[model samples]
Target: MRFVPLVLAALLLIAGQTAAARPPSAVFLNVVAHQDDDLLFLTPDLSQTLKASVTVYVTSGEGSHPESMTPEDYAEMRQAGERNAYATMAGVANRWDRVALRTGTGTTAELATLRARPSVKLVFLRLHDWSDLHGLWNGEVASGGTVLPTGSPARVEDTYTRDKLTKTLTWLMDHFRPTVIRTQNPAPLSGFYAPDPDNPDHTAVARFTNLAAESYEGKAQVRNYRGYDDAQLPTGLDPALRAERTKAFRAYADVDTNVATLFDDTASYLGWRQTMLNRWPSGVSWTDGADEAYAVLGDEVKRWRRNVFGEWGKPVGLGGSGFAPAVTVARQADGRLRLFSLNRNTFDVVTAVQDRFGDYSGWTSLGNPNGPGGDQTGLPAAGTDAQGRLWFFVRNGGGGVSARQQNADGTFGDWQDMHGWGVQDGLSVVSAGGRLQVFATQCSARLYVTATCSIARLVQGESGFEWDTSVVPGAAATAPTAVAGTDGKAHVYFRATGTAAVLMAVDGVVTDLGNPGGPGEVAATATGEVYARNAAHGISARGASGWRAVGGHTEASPAVVGRGVVSIGVDGRLTQLVH
Candidate 1:
């Protein structure tokens, strides 16, 4: 099939061209461990794909029991359910054209394309549910092999190791050349608990998928969806979305007898259908000083300096490259600005210091806390506490927060792990009342599904930091952005679950700040002004009078510097809204 034409057409159509109209060329590659996993966890995102899409099932999904049927029959039944579900999602007839393709790793996998919608394809690796893939990943079993389903067109005689599985997935990605890839969360805080709590096939498949994504040559955007762990979070889906997902899942549940009863258990099934969370949500990094604001524009750092007349000057690039858009800036007591950004290639936290002359030094790398090979760190959050000391905090590889403070003599101290686990990224740090208050969202540790998350606060104490966690009265959809108010209290802002309404919490009181309908990090300024992206992708700010339009489009969250609001425009340039 000619995919280049399709991609070109999609690009043109997305660019609002009126020329030759064609199907979208964008391809989505969704890698899941089980047949129903995609239907349960990846939808409305999976259903929203406009063009060609492919789903790779890494396992046969034949749990410990075959349900009075042979393992092959059970696996085939699951595959058939998936076909029907995909047909339902595509609004087509439940018919497929099945074939066998030999991969570069010498493995023959079954590929099925919807007869009515050829752009939708499915690849079944036919590996056993938990024992083959999960066991191999855990080193409990060294050599595992695939099993051909009952009506499969292929005969798989090859054995698979962890490395071999990763390579095979990479080969598939190379073949499909997807523009976007979706997979399960590799580092889930909780494990699967249905048949066995220790069976983590979803995690294993995600790990392999990430490895494949890293090795793939294409520039595909990768998004990791929370699997079973999403159950513990709030139900963020609207009723219409829940119904749509239920309809698609019901199509699959109708074919598989094992989970067909889930429909009768409305509460349990609704828990899975109502929530679909992304593991690494994008965060906007911004900071400001007395007369200057700094933010990441494109892959470089940019600064907007205030003139003598209090007019903001044009943004100037600081000449650093390969940096992620997320950045944090801390103003020193001596009137210098310190900028921190993640190196896109190495995932290392790099920083540049501004001198009195307003020029920035070259970015110096602060080695990843997880050591040289770890790529699990999130963007760094920087703040200046009492005594003119700079502190940097980042979500570590082990799902906890780690901190490093600047020494008095201009050097940095060793990283100290704060050991706060089950936390999402988008950390907010501010110095309030002569102490540092680090705010983060702490996920629930419940084994079952629930809508529970707390705003975790780490406050500086005389003998180190003390934890004071409070449950968010309302459901929070995104990570919280906090600012120290003039009253010396921390004000937190977050997008509410289900409604997408921006909400604020102060002194344990939660208030609705109106729904902007866009999802991202909410920006709270020190002067009690709140900013969020509206449905049209324009920045909206709330002040003493009410919410007002800021009149600029930004892909990243808005930030405040001095009295001006700054946002990275869609064109990767700085747009400031002066108050």
Candidate 2:
């Protein structure tokens, strides 16, 4: 392994700091397909956190360059561009110290730390771009293949099969221990709005990153960003922020001849620079009961009790395994709290019930009606009817809603397919009177590309559930969260498609709650107070007195527990703030 003298000193200093000070409170990891992907699609957010960020370039980013520029040379050039861009973002000199790293999997990778800001690092796996990733994804690539970038000091030889790539990513996660892992969209828009679709390499990298995250032991929150298709979405950044982002990209453009024109003619790259959208914005699950709050930390369910002073006690873990990070809590007629979650490995709906003494039973699989594959099922949502019967709902494999209700004997009935198509995840089920109301975002096409998307409501009728296809006005971007208000009306909350503005619909009337939006489902309390994640990842609550900032950097939506709000912190711990 080779490292410059300065880099060696920096590494020793970093090691010393690691031994002395506490680990970073927040470490943001950006895993992208190409060198410039983060600058183009994930910037502003990327630049904003330069002090606590590490970006990984999965591919060499050598896309059809001129014959004069060899593939290795092109990869080096791109890496240089990225280094320069990140240096600019860090407000430091354009000098980076390169060090060779051997990942836990025994594969040699390159790590470049900004000379002035060691925390702003860049990792290059230097895998072949496009076809190689696609081949790995399809299992056509053989093991033992080797890729060596131009300036790589060691002979890093690895075939980069799907499993190997995923393992490598997991190894990186273990090394960095990021609080947030951001990647390109695993399921990118195609057909209508995206004629070209996202680069297959982007999708492949994202899928591998997510798989790695799932296999990783740490509690890192995974976020997916839109790739080229983000151009079709409305501009997410304001003018001032856009200007700042452009400066960083321009620094990169200066080093890369391929995108040099972007430096002078900024209009061509404006769409991508001005907009940054998350493929899955919703956060982890937190459910509020009468006196306690339940949150899913990693795969296990944890409960927090409220004391008489309205303060929440430290959480007690409710043991479960192989479950998704999101959970739904429903109250049983006998006052037990039942939790529902999707099985991460099998996509099956799993349930666990809390006993009278607050001890949780072992998780019981509810068997997915959407078949066995993990992708076929979404997170489960649970609610209790006026009759006090518990019902569980999930987005089935067919993009429709499937439900199961508690039987009179306490066991759940067979899964019933509530026929509606193209529904997204993050289903919200609220019970008012004797009926259950299910609100979700049903799109005509893929969410990022869809021109026709709305909040669809499925209301339980005397015969069965009937669908109100367009219950909310305007285009909805996220799955709707509905709560039955004290006025006995179902109040629906969703983020508007183009504006990202939080909107509430009640009795056919729509109210625009100002955009404090980042990405995630809008949450509402039982008493009608609304909460949504703001741009800074903090909670914003709108109550009778209007909107107020609820300070907490959370990984998911805030849960309203009685007079307090509960959120999962960036470190994957549950935090409750009493009003």
Candidate 3:
């Protein structure tokens, strides 16, 4: 998998610029409960959020075993590796922060930060880490590996006390104010709905996370982004079969539906082979991410490479990361809620509420909506309007940007052409009042992340074909973005000759925010204060307090939800601002 250095560098340069442009909308407090959770569960999202802020709340290491490493040692190494990795990708390691909280496995941890920024802190409550090697099942058919259930989440034996668990989690909720929280399920064959009470650590994580969300009283969104209860270990699939699943798996490991960033986000993501999660046998440690130790080299009898990498990876039956293929949760200022993701092109909204999610195993047809076979490429931004109306906007290849509104009743509105005459490669939509605000970027040919969302729009003639307008100070002409701010104003920001151009409707009169950077993005928080991310920095401006973060790395537009708070999931992490 030798790639051209130049191409990768070029892509990075472009991607870097893009990151400074679009930036994500959601302010995520990664409710991760296990090790390598982001990779195995939300690879697609982690792929894109690499540029944003993500705080991992880990209970245990690879396997909740003292043999793996001491709690103190494990915490240091894990945090160090994580920080180094994040800095390598985001390029703004200094802006990030990390802190460890004290508590039992049953409790949660809360740290400090503003409404915006990666305000998440890790709570290494001394909970049992579910061993990829040991669980409900015993080793060898004769080993006594059976599914067990223990009642009460606080009863994880001598682990964290119930009181300790509650306090930790309470502190976490009160401090971060996370709207979207994620965790694992009780069992493998089951999902969030299933109940696996035996493992106190597993059960505690779920119970504790739920408790936090509940404490917020639906004021935040919650979802189990992981739960591959099955066996994360490789099936030792006779070589040939293993390769097949890996490719399909990579397709998903590539993109983030929410962030719209790159796929295969990890530095080693590209060269990843058959890193098997579980090895039916133990003999291996997934703690150090040691691929060689747990790998199979065709066994001489069968020369096949199953890239089984459990160490520092996900667990058995799970994505070797204790994560999911694709799970989208929509949270907002009001509270926590579930989000529906239409499997790629299948507009059919695959409702995998429990065990049925993505289970093509017993599955039939999903009636993909982006046309029969479906366009796995991408879908337009799906947002709800004031009237409780569900909206669907697509950057139809030839049909320009088409939009359709779906009501809670499952019905749809007429598909209208918002970007008339010409077509765009990207589509973003936000509702302000009764009107729908959409933003798009027209690619010269195909689409790329560099398709700036922050760029200001200088509408070409009438067809809307050319996007030669930008907000970047001194940057030449570039395409601009079309977005509806929270204050009921529409804005378009872009880059020009490295500079930036901001065009927005201020009381019917278009006003410029300022010159922060190029092909950048702008999001309004509470009172219509706009925050833009461009170049390798960010800019914020409101009433009197002008724009700041002059240095930002944005690749997606801001998704502002709360009154004074705005969340921005970038590169591969979640960062935000609270005024």
Candidate 4:
């Protein structure tokens, strides 16, 4: 591995600061399975966060049985290659000093320090890298299956009970105190990795990292990046960034030295380019782009929901400072209510739940169901079904539909592709007549003056969910909202193209309700009352007393909770009128 004594001596002689202590600008720690994993899955952002960053490799990339190289040679070469790769990323010389790091269990592992930039470091745990065997080990750790023994396999000496690993990780956190932590995807889709598909080692590392972080409860924010699934998804980076990534991987795969290596020319490393998808922390912005607007009413009030108590619990040093159209609300069967909103800081789907006693939980993220939803303009639709399953849908960045449902245990199922294409507008979902119906608007070029926008429907039937699209003609300019009325029929509402009049669709018939006042946000209640927000942001209902304004100015569209309606104020407080 070409260890030079001169560099080690110089690095040791000139050190007043430990790698753990640095200026509090930003410190990022990335925990990955193998050597090249961070480059393959966490990149451009990983490279961007280079200042004061530490990467921890759980496995030394030495397989259980090496066919062409000795285990020592393989481990050393992989470590050197990783040094070279990070050096290339930092645009500096490839010289690092090796040191010993004692874990919580009192055993030592190798830690490398970049000579040019002391802020960047690499810690190797030297664990076995067998795919099938380590996968089994990882699965056991993930499911709390078994406590792994220490000092097995003979080559690398450290033993790792899941608790020991977690403690060591917690020790690292307490030492470094990073501001941000990134790890691989701990959870993947069911059946997506059934037949020996994804790497189990990657999932295991991510889970262990999460456990450690939870135990430590440090100030650092955690983000989970997708691993092997990148190969199947579209490339997320542009050409320039992709070219730089190619260079980094080339360095990681270089193996012309005397030492045997895990990376060689035969591997398809050149073609390994794809977008890095991550579950951005609840309130942190992944990008600097201005927040996109949505035609749906609920999409605008997310900021109020996220920062209702100010910045006490905002994600990753971020706070909801302004208004955005990204809130949706659904009522649970037992008088509880769920408020869904896009994080003002991240623009990702985040939600808060209220119990029957009116106590609200902290806002939790469901992540971006679609990988950045095409153009970072993801429009979310949320509702509760007949069985109280909270369903979430998003118009993806590729202009396609994706969905997921909350399980009975309160966990969410993996996002499922609903296969609706060319859907660029906002979406609305309703559970009616024991069926879940999704409504969206699609535009098509016509033989007339301009393109025509029409409403499309996908409803669940005896044979499963089927598309009965373009059932009613509508404007493509704005989004649509739908709700199942107490009459056991579906009611859809939207603004007609180029008009302020609110249109209603029921039983495949479209009727105009006339313009009540200004732009109106509409919703149907449990009492069969169709309500809309008026010009002054007040709630008005089409009730037995005729269409009349009932409340004062509301910050956004009000949500139906049980038999009444509730709204949030600009000062981040909820006002419920139980009529």
> For residues 1-579, could you state the per-residue lDDT of candidate 4 as single tens digits?
353332433212222122244446456788988878888777765776576878998876675325666766666667777888899999998887776566555545667788998888988777667543254445543312111112212122556666667777777776676666778866542211224325778877876776677655345446666655344333334455556666777777664242224333222233234344453212111111111111111112222222333222211212222112344455555555566655433446766666666555466777675454232335456767666777877765555677778887666788777776656335777788888888876554222113355678878777656777756665533356676777888787765654445678888888877544433245555455565555444666666555677674442455554445554432233454434
- Per-residue lDDT of model 2, residues 30-77, tens digit only: 999899899988876777777678899887887655588888777778
- For residues 88-196, write the lDDT of model 1, one tens digit per residue: 8889877777777677777778778887888899988888777788788778998787776766666655688888898889888878777667788665543323433
Off by over 4 Å in 1: 1-26, 139-142, 190-198, 264-269, 286-380, 394-402, 416-425, 432-435, 449-451, 461-464, 470-475, 484-490, 497-500, 516-520, 523-579
lDDT of each: 0.72, 0.72, 0.34, 0.57
* Pairs clashing within candidate 2: 145-159
In terms of TM-score, which candidate is stronger, 1 or 4?
Answer: 1
Deviation of model 4 at 419, angstroms: 10
Q: What's the C-alpha lDDT at position 141 in model 4? A: 39
When summed lDDT is taken over every stretch of 10 residues in candidate 4, the lowest stretch is 284-293
Choose the strongest candidate by TM-score. Answer: 2
Which rank order by lDDT, best down to worst?
2, 1, 4, 3
Sorted on TM-score, highest at the top, how do the candidates line up? Answer: 2, 1, 4, 3
Which scores better on lDDT, 2 or 3? 2
| TM per prediction | 0.73, 0.84, 0.33, 0.54
lDDT, residue 479, model 2? 68
